[model samples]
Target: MTILSDIPRLLPEGMALGPALDRALAILERAGFSAVIYDYTPVPRSHDGSLITPNILEARRVPEDMLALWKSGFYQLDPVQDAALATAAPFVWSGLGKQSRVMDEVIRERHRPVLGYMHDMRFSFGVTVPIHQPRGDLATFTAIRIDAEPDFAADAAEIVPQIGVLGQIFHDVVSAGFDAETRRTHHVRLTPRERECLSLCADGLTAKEIARRIERSVPTVTLHLNAASRKLGARNRFQAVARAAHYRLIEAAPAA
Candidate 1:
C-alpha cells in the first residue's frame, strides 16, 4: 500500500514535531523512501532579517560537513530555497540549469560537494512541498529518490497532504509554546462554567442540550460557549472543543 494510505497506522499518538517527523519519514521509507527532510524558514525577525530552520535532524543523522554548511547559512543562497520562498504549493527540481544565473555560482562553487554526493549516490530527482503560513513564513518537505523510478514521484505525491497536516500541527505547537507531548499533561485553567459548557459541547451537545444538562437556559449556554470561544480564539463550537482537547481542558469523549 502507498504511504498515504498507511498514515493512520504510522502516525504516533503525540503531536510533537520530532515524533511527527520521524513517523512521516518512516512512512516514506516503508513505502520505499530515498531521503526525506522537512525544511522550515521563518521570515527574518527584522526587515532585513535572516531565515531559520530549527535543525530538526539529529547530529548523527546528517553528514557533519553538510550540517556545518547549513549552520553557516550557505543554504540561504540555494535556489531551492528561493523556489520554496516564491510559492505556497509543491514543486519539483531535478537539477541546476546552466542558465539559472542567480543560482549557478552558489551551486557550482559552494553547494556542489553535497549535490555531487547525492548525484553519485544515485539520488536523482526530488519533490519539495512548501507549507506557507499567513505570516509570510514557509516550511518545506523535500523527498528525494535514488534511482530512475517513474512512479516514485506519483507515489510520493500521495503522502504530501498528510505531511501538510503535520506541518500545520507543527506551527500550532510552536505558536502555543507546548508540543503534543507537553500538551497531554497541560492544564488550561478554565472556569467551572466554561469547562462544563465545553465538556457538553464536545459530546455533540447543542446549546439546548448543554443548557438542559446544566439546568441553564439555552441563551445562557450560548453565552458561555461564546465566551469560551472568544477566550480560546476559536471560530466556533467544534473548534472550541478541539482546542480544549488539545490543551487538556476537556476529554475526547467529553463528560456524559
Candidate 2:
C-alpha cells in the first residue's frame, strides 16, 4: 500500500494544480485505487445571487464520455454528490442509505438515465471524502476501484480515512494555487469580534443590545458588524448575519 508519509512532497514549490493533482492521484493509484476525482464548490456568497458552478478540480482515469455527461448536468442526479453536499464526512458510495421512500423512488425512476449511464461506465464502487469549508464551500474527493476485487469493500473501509486526509491535503494545495481573486472568493475569515456580533445578530438582538451584552460601546459593535458584513459580502446587518450563519462562522440560531 502506498503510505503518503510526506504529502507535502507531492507539491513542490511552483507546481501547478494539474501536476500536483496528478502526483496525488499517483499516490492513490499506488494504494490500489484505479481512479480518482476531486470536486470543489466555491463559497456561494461570491456568486452574487447567480448560479454557483462546481469545479472539477482534478480527475484521473475518468472516461471522456463520462466527464462530458457529468458536465452536461448528470451530476445533479448523482446520489454521491447529494450526499457530499449534505454531509462533511468520508463515506463509501455503497454505504449511503436512501433519504426516504420518496427520494428512493425518485432516484430509481426519475434518475434512471443517469443511473444507467453510471452503471455502463463500470464505476460501481468507490469511497468519497467530503470536505466542508467554514465558508460554505463543499468539496469531495473520490477514489474508485472499477474492477472490484473480493476485498474491495474491505480495503475501502480501511483506507477511506486516509483518502479523507488526502482530500484535505489536496484541497489545501489546490487552494494555495488559486489566484488572489479566486482565493478571496472561496475563503473568508472573520475576526472573533465580528463572529460574536454576527452570533448576537442571529439571536435577533439589536446593535445596542449586542453592545451591552458584549460590554463594548455601540459604535465599536457597529464597526465590527460593518466589517463582518463587508468580509461576508453582505449588503446589511441582516444579510451579514445570514451569510455568517451559512458559512458556519456563527450559529444560525441562539441557544435556548
Candidate 3:
C-alpha cells in the first residue's frame, strides 16, 4: 500500500497538529525513511510573539538530542530553516566534515548550533515540504533517514505535491472546525421551546403543525422559529435549517 492509503485512517477529530503529522511520519518510516517533521506556521508574528508550533513531536526512531534541540528553539536560528523560509525549495545537506555548505554557515554564524551539533551525532537523509496556507501561513514536512540509508529527496519530490493537495483539505476541514468552535463558544441561549420549534420547522413542518405536535399555539411556534432564525443570522426558515445542519446543531434528518 502507498502512503496515501494511510491518510484516511490517520486523521481523527480534534488535536489537529500532532496526531495528523505523526501519521504522515509513520507512513514515511514504513517506506524506509527515518524521521519526519511537519511544521505549520500560521503567521510570522504570533499573538504573543513566541514561536507557535515549536517542535510538536519527535518520533522514537529519530535522534533523541535532535528532538531536544528542536524543543529548545534551535530552529529559530538554523540557517537552513531561514533559507527554506526565504524560499520554498528543498535540497540535500551533505556531511558537515569540512563540507556541507548549509551546516558550515549555520555553525560559523552560531545562529543555532543545533544543526551543526547534529552533524557529529546522526547522519540523516531526509526531505522537507513547505506547505503554504491560503491565509498565508507556512507549514513544512521533513522526513529524516536513519544511518543515511533512505533517499528522502527522491521520496519527497514524489510526495510533496501529494501533501500539497492534502494541505487544501486540511485548510478546509480546520476552517470548518474553527467556525464550529466559535459558534459553540458564543452559542445563543435559546429556550427549549424555541429549539424544538426550530428543529421541527427545519423538518418542513408548518408553524401550525409544529404547534399541534409540541402543544403550543401557532403564533407561539412562529415566534420561536422566527427568533431562532434571527439568532442564527439566517434570513428565513430554510436558511436557518441549513446553517444549523452545517453547525451540527441539528441531526441530518431528511426533509419531509
Candidate 4:
C-alpha cells in the first residue's frame, strides 16, 4: 500500500498546471480521498474593497453547482473559507469545533436556501490545508472523502505535514505562469514611513495609537497611510495594509 509519506515523490515535474494537478490528485485519491480542490487568492480583496472569491486553480470530482455558487458570492458564507483565513495550519472540517457550530447555525438561520448543499453534494468529510505566503496571501488545498470510515480523521492527521508541503508546491507551480503584468502590478514599492504605518496597522494599532507609538502626529500617520494606499492602488486602509503585506513592504507581525 502506498502510504502518505510517498506522496511527495509522486508529484510530476515540468508538466502543465492541469496535468501536474491531475497527478497530485491521483495520489490523494489513492490515499482514500474521493476528490480534491485547490483554490488560490492572489489578491484577497477586489478593486472595490470587498474580499475576493478564491479562484479555483484545479479540482477533481467537485460539483459544478458548488463552483458556480462559490463564484456567485456564496463563498462569503462558506465556513471552510472562514476557517482557512483564521489559521495557518491544516485542519479537518469535521473536527473544526467552533467553525462546525457556526456553519450549522449559518445553515439553519442565515443561509437556509443552501441548507442541504453539503449533504446533497456528498461532502461530509474533508481536510483543508491553508498555505501561508510570506506576503500574507492565503491559498487553500482541500481533499474530500465522502462516506469515510470512522478512523479516517485520525489516519489523515498523520499526513497533514505532507499535505501542506504538496499544497505549497502546487501553489508555486501554478503561480509561476502568472502574466508579467500581473506580477508587476503586485510588486509596488513603499517608502519607509509608509511601510512603518502599514506595519503598525497590521499589529492592530489604531491611527492615534500608531501616531503615539511612532512619535508622529495623528494627521502625519494618516497622511502616510493615504499615500501607501494610493501607491498600492488600494481602495481603503484595510486593503492598503493587505497589499503592503503582500509586497513585503511591511511585515505582518504583531507589535512586541
TM-score of each: 0.49, 0.62, 0.49, 0.61
Q: List the residue pairs that clash in candidate 2.
A: none
Model 3 steric clash pairs: 35-144, 37-142
Q: lDDT, candidate 2, residue 189?
A: 79
Report the C-alpha lDDT of model 1 over 12-55, residue by residue, as the tens digit. Answer: 34455566666666655675656666554434222223344332
What is the lDDT ranking, best to worst? Answer: 2, 4, 1, 3
**Best-matching candidate per lDDT:** 2
Residue 207 miss distance in model 4 (angstroms)? 26
Q: Where is model 1 more than 4 Å wrong at Cα?
A: 6-9, 44-46, 49-64, 95-122, 147-256
Clashing pairs in 1: none
Instruction: Write down the lDDT of every candidate, Cα atoms only.
Output: 0.58, 0.70, 0.55, 0.69
Off by more than 4 A, model 4: 1-9, 45-50, 95-115, 181-256
For model 4, residues 179-200, the per-residue Cα lDDT tens digits are 6343322336577789889998
| lDDT of candidate model 1 versus the reference | 0.58
Candidate 3, 5-107: lDDT as tens digits: 6455665455355555566556666666666655444343232323333312334356566666775676565554554455555544433323234434444
RMSD of candidate 1 to true structure, Å: 12.8
Clashes of 4: 0
Clashes of each: 0, 0, 2, 0
Model 4's TM-score against the true structure: 0.61
* Model 3: lDDT to the true structure: 0.55
Off by over 4 Å in 2: 44-52, 94-109, 180-256
